[model samples]
Target: MSTATDLAELTARVRAHLALRHPDSPIGDLKTLPGGHSGLTYSVTAGDARYVVKAVPPGQRPVGRNDVLRQARVLGALAGSAVPVPAVVASDDRQPAWFAMDFAAGEAVEPVLDAPEVPAGTARARMLEIASVLRRLHGTDIRTPGLGAPEPLDAAGELARWSRTLHAVPAELRPGGEELLTRLADALPSDGRQPVLLHGDFRLGNVLCAGERAVAVVDWEIWSVGDPRIDLGWFLLFTDHRNFPHLGRAVPGLPTEAELLDTYRDGRPPLPAMDWFRALGRMKMAAIMGHNLRRHREGKHHDPDQERLPPTIAAMIRTARDLLA
Candidate 1:
C-alpha cells in the first residue's frame, strides 16, 4: 500500500538520517526492500558501500515502538557474541525515524524453504545453530543501557496481551480463535523464573541462510527480554506439520522437540513450564494469522495464501489442545 510519494519521502528521510550519522560516507542511490507489513526497509548504496535502513511509518508511528533503534541496540549488545546478528553501523532514534546498518549480502532463506534440494539435515543443523544462538542471547547479562529495560512477561501477562490482541481482531474472524485463546488463558503456567532476552520472532523466514548455514538474523522488531521457549514454540508452529502433503520431504532441518529443548536448556535448570509456554505460542500464532486473514477478508490487504489459513489455524488449535491434554 506504499505510494511512490511515500517511498520518495521515506528515501529522503533515510538519506538525511544516514548523512547525519555517517557524514563521511557518500551515499548513492536508494532502493526499497520488499516483504514487510508493518515497517519500511530500504537498501542503499554509498560510494560503492551498501547499507540497509529500517524505519517505522512516518505519521502513524507507534509510541515506544522503534524497531530500527531496538535492532541496532540488540546488534550492538550482541557484538563479539556467538549470535549471528547483523552489525549496526549507525542508529538514529529521532524524528522522521530510521536506523542504518550494513546490508547483509546473502540471499534470503525464505524462497528455499520450499525448495526440493535443500536437505532436511542441513535445515536441522541451521535450526540447531539458531537455537544455540538464542540460548546464548538469553544467557547474556542484560544490564546494558540503551537496549531498554528487560520486560519478561509471565504466562498470565502473555495470555493477557494475546487475549487483548485477539479481541481487537474483527468479529468475523473470531469463531474458532476465541476458544483457542480461552484454552491458553485458562491453562497458563505459573513457573519460568529465569528470563533472558528473546528474539520474539525466531522463524526460518526471518533468517538469511547460504546453503546450510545462517549468515544473518533479520527482523528484530519483536525482539525483547522474555522466556526463550516462546521462540522455540513459534518456530515449531511454522515449520512442523503433521498434515501437510509434503511433510516427509517438505519438513527438513527440524529438531525433535526433545532435541530443541536440550539445545535450548544446554544443562541449565529445567524449564518446568515449557509445555504451557509452547501451547501459548501456538495460540499466539493463531491469533496473528486470524488478524491477517481478517484484514484480507475486509479487502484491506491481499494475500494469495489467505485461503490456506483456516486449516493452519485448525492445526494450531489441535496442537494446543494436544499439548494441554
Candidate 2:
C-alpha cells in the first residue's frame, strides 16, 4: 500500500532516526526491500555502511510500540551464542516505528521445499546443521530482565489459542482446517515436556545460507518463549511435502520426522502432545495465509507474492489432516 509519497515520508523519518542514533554517519540511497506482508523493509546505505530498516505501516501501527524492540533484545542476547542472528544497531518503539540493524549479506534459504542441485548428503548435513542451531537456541536459558517470560502457552493454552485463530477466519475460507483442528484437539498428547524459548517460526525462509552453511536467521516478529516442540513442528510442517517435486529439490536428504523428534528430545523427556503442536503450527499457517489472502482481495494490501496463499492454505490443511491420521 506504499506509494512514492509514502516512501518519501518513510525515508525522511529513517534519516532522522539514523541521525539521532549515529550523528557522525552520512546516510546514502534508501531503497525498499521486497518480501513480508506485515511491514515494510528498507535497505539503506550510510557512507560505506549498510543497514536494514523494518517499520510498521502508517495509520496501521501495532496496538503497542514497535515489536522490533523485542527482536533486538533477543538477537542481542544471541550475540555470542551459537545462533546466527543479524547484528542490532538501533531499535525504537516510538513513532516512525522502526529498527535498524547491520544488513546480513547472504541469500535467504527459501523455496526449501524444492530439491537443490547440491548433493543429497550435503543438503542433509546442512539441514542437520540448521537443526543444531535451532537446538542450541531452544536449549539456551532466557534469564535476562525484560527478555525472559513464562512459557507462552501450556498444552491447553495452545489448543485454545490456535482454535481461536482458526475460528477467526471467515467460514468460507476455513477449508478443511476446522476438521483438522478438532482431530488435533481430541488427540492432544498428555505427557508434554518442559517449555523453552521457541523461535516461533523456524522455517527455511527465515534462515539465510551461504553455500552449505547457515549465515544468519531473520524474521523474529513471532519469536517467544514456548514449547520447543512448537518450533520443531513448524519446521516439519513447512518442509515435509510428500507430493511436490520442489520438495525434493528444497531439502535433499532432509531428516525423517522421527530423526527430528529424536534430535529435539536429545536425552530430555518426551513431549506428549508433539503431534498436536505440529497440527497447531499447520493451522496457524493456514489462518495466516487465509488472512493475507483476504487482505489482498479486499484491497487492504496488494502484495503479489501473497497470491499463492489460497492453494498453499489448501495444501497446509491436507498436511495437517495427514499428521492427525
Best-performing candidate as measured by TM-score? 1
**Count of steric clashes across candidates, in order:** 2, 9
Candidate 1 shows a clash count of 2
Question: For residues 60-110, what per-residue lDDT tens digits would candidate 2 score against the true structure?
Answer: 755322455666677887776788998888776766467788888865554
Score candidate 1 by TM-score against the native: 0.86
The list of candidate 1 runs beyond 4 A from truth reads 1-13, 16-26, 62-67, 108-117, 170-176, 243-249
Alpha-carbon runs more than 4 Å astray in model 2: 1-13, 16-25, 64-66, 111-122, 146-151, 243-252, 267-270, 299-312
Clashing pairs in 1: 123-253, 124-253
lDDT of each: 0.69, 0.71
Tens digit of per-residue lDDT, candidate 1, span 224-286: 676666776766554455523222234554677778778877887766767777777777766
